[model samples]
Target: MPVEPDCIVVGGGLAGLACARELACRGRSVRLLEAAAASGGRVATDTVDGFRIDRGFQVYLDAYPEGRRQLDLDALKLGRFEPGALVAEGRRLRRVTDPWRRPLAAVRSLVDGTVGLGDALRVARLRGELLGRMEAGGIDPDRPVAADERTTRAALEARGFSTRFIARFFEPFFGGVFLERGLDTAETVFEFTFAMFALGSACLPAGGMAAIPRQLASGLPADVVEVGTPVAAVEPVATVERGAVRLADGQRRACRAVVVATDRRAAERLLPPGSLPATDAGVTRGDKGARMVAFAAERSPIGGPTLLVSADRAGPIDNLTVPSDVVAGYAPAGAALIYASVRPDWAGDDAAAAADVLRQARGWFGSHVEQWRPLATLRIGHALPDESPAARRWRPTGPRLAPGLFICGDHVTSGSINGALVGGHRAAAAVDAELASG
Candidate 1:
């Protein structure tokens, strides 16, 4: 508290922590301030009755090129969910597995017409194309997913995929990934994510998603990162009166430079109008948020480490999973845990939505759903940056807000853990350059 650092990082999420750490490594004094009781922003976990419930359903993808540079996968000890999902039909569920991984289940799905052979083949074809594009730097996040502005549906149709395939599979599967249906997000996001899956398995750390940021922070000095330290404002140009950060308690902390790494709304609130170079363009704020309800079950309902996709898409529930199936110690003695999610924007009122979800889930597991107990609900208001055509076309202009001010977050880049880490390092590089020039 007594030392005046060269850089002050606001919002102790992955981006901010990464920025602070990088600046410290460069031999510049650094201080990271987090408003919340803990870091990780949206990447948080809750321990309820011995079960760890993550904030919404999030996966630590090992394939994120940027994240791989920042984290050691082997040290995290990740657990994987099966390659494919169980698509839900009228009232029953059909198991669809990756042909390359689970040949028998893929063949069975083809035989049962659960997933048309043409569609299955198309999925495989797209996988190859994306992986190739990613390796060759053709589908970089810097490059828009689509060549021009168009709906994801249009892109899929142009690629020759049928409407049935898009409605049934892409909606629940990727929609769950994007958290919005009708391909409202950029097709490029879908493409990059697909390539990621093709390249690496979807995984969770042995501890939980929170371990991600904790690991990043653990390497830094203890006093450098401060949790529960809310920042109320930032000075545009450092002055004797206004130094680096204006604390919520009316105290000012002076620093040679300041990097604000917070969400869209917080960034808008903290900085002066039009100070954010990356967000000044058509960056979109998602109107929808993902609601995750964790349940304690008597046993595994789906019976495997696979996500159950809702083909109907009419019900409140989008998909369900048993975390216990993916990793051990998720439940108490002789019990299991189930994670259910719904797009609340589609689902009706709160009571109606919960009722509809439980009822529809009953359709899948029969009366056994009644035995499941509702435990926790995590609602992430700003889950994703709306990747519209204009938004997708966005590229970083520079990383300077003023002589010594900077900004970084998912909003500044691709909108993922990878984007955050990449953006953080980018900000650090800018800070290093400016400080050196001085």
Candidate 2:
């Protein structure tokens, strides 16, 4: 029989790995299992032709409060994008600065003859109203709390945001992130992400996007890791004598408790009928977006200033960033890396879709594009757990479904990287508490 450890963590992404690390740190023997050849999940990166390319444009806002406390960021060298944004609207490039530093930029933007003062003022007023609602507890921070269910475009139009501002800013900027336009998403997501933006701008790691999980994995005590050992099934009601996990390769390991930290879809397969809250929880993907496309060039196309282009209010391509300037090692000397991402319709063609996006990009950067070349691409689906209205309702109270079973993942309230860490810590603490009570 294979040696049974104190705990068995069923995934190796940020949440699973964090659970394993936390358990090990507490002197509990742990067996961390990963389905992929390596760890990190969507946190992907690649290097080729002497340039580094992340799976997508992953910028860590300095304001993500949880990121600061959980991960030892110093160990992973980081970088940042420029402060302001260059918006491409109707034959002219408009600049939008951070509301704090460039109060003038906002004022000037109102008068720049783009959206006109009336539309701009309407947007500002709507923003204030949304913030006010949030402060009043009208918005639920934990769930998909939309003031109403309408397309983002309809919501903005209802609030009096002009077509120009929607096309220039919302479609290209937030659209790229959420993978939608017409902004029909739940209002709560907009509030959360917008709050993050206001807290601080985006940032990148010097090495690559992989550096984050890589760093987290590195800190774990070596004695606990188990690579290439895929967990076949988890029997939450198993006897301590029989062990908690039943492996596919005819292996059995016993543990005091278990953390099911796989993705929501996969977790649904592994968990019992009543284990999860609902296959679809609070948020639903009303629409989908295209895969992310990254490229490392002999030189970066992004100039000293970051350029963002939105073709129209419902534009597909949202924003663009050049990370080489922020991080020294992203490209070879005197060269830089450019990351471009777009949101294609659910049934959009891949190559054709990419080409259409590229055409739009050429309109802005033109000849400067010669030096840059294509890199890796990534598409994240159901990033937030699929929580649709029709799904049944069920919420697990504590770590154990039975006496020695537990679950953890972004699906559980803590969705972001920080949330994953917190979930892992909570699971471990729950196990500790149960053991103490015994």
Candidate lDDT values, in order: 0.80, 0.64
Shift of residue 207 alpha carbon in model 1, Å: 1.4
Q: Give all TM-scores, in the order shown.
A: 0.93, 0.83
Global lDDT of model 1: 0.80
Evaluated at residue 180, the lDDT of candidate 1 is 78
**Residue 203 shift from truth in candidate 1, angstroms:** 1.4
- The residue-by-residue lDDT of candidate 2 on 1-438, one tens digit each, is 137677788888877777777777777777788877788765767787667777656566665555676677766776666655777764357787664556877778667665577776775676576667655756443433333444456666777777766776777776665555545444545665666666566777878878888877887877566667777778756434433776668677677677787876677677656666543455443324246666666666656536465554333455667777678878888777776666545344556545555666776778666555666656756454422222212334445666667877765533356556666777777766665675
lDDT of 1 by residue, 1-438 (tens): 448887899999999988988888888888999999998887887889988798888887788898888887888878888898888877988887778888998889889887887888788888788888898987755432444766666678888888888888888888888777768666776778888877877888878788899899997888998888999989877454324789998988888788989986798799866685454444555545788778888899987778888877568787888888887766776788888887645647554555677888998889999998888766677787766656655533546677888888877766788878987888999988988888
Model 1 ranges with Cα > 4 A deviation: 142-149, 238-243, 277-284, 394-396
Q: In candidate 2, which residue ranges exceed 4 Å CA deviation? A: 114-164, 182-185, 238-243, 279-290, 305-316, 346-348, 378-384, 387-402
Q: In terms of lDDT, which candidate is strongest? A: 1
TM-score, cand. 1 vs. native: 0.93
Among all candidates shown, the one with the greatest TM-score: 1
**Residue pairs clashing, model 1:** 145-188
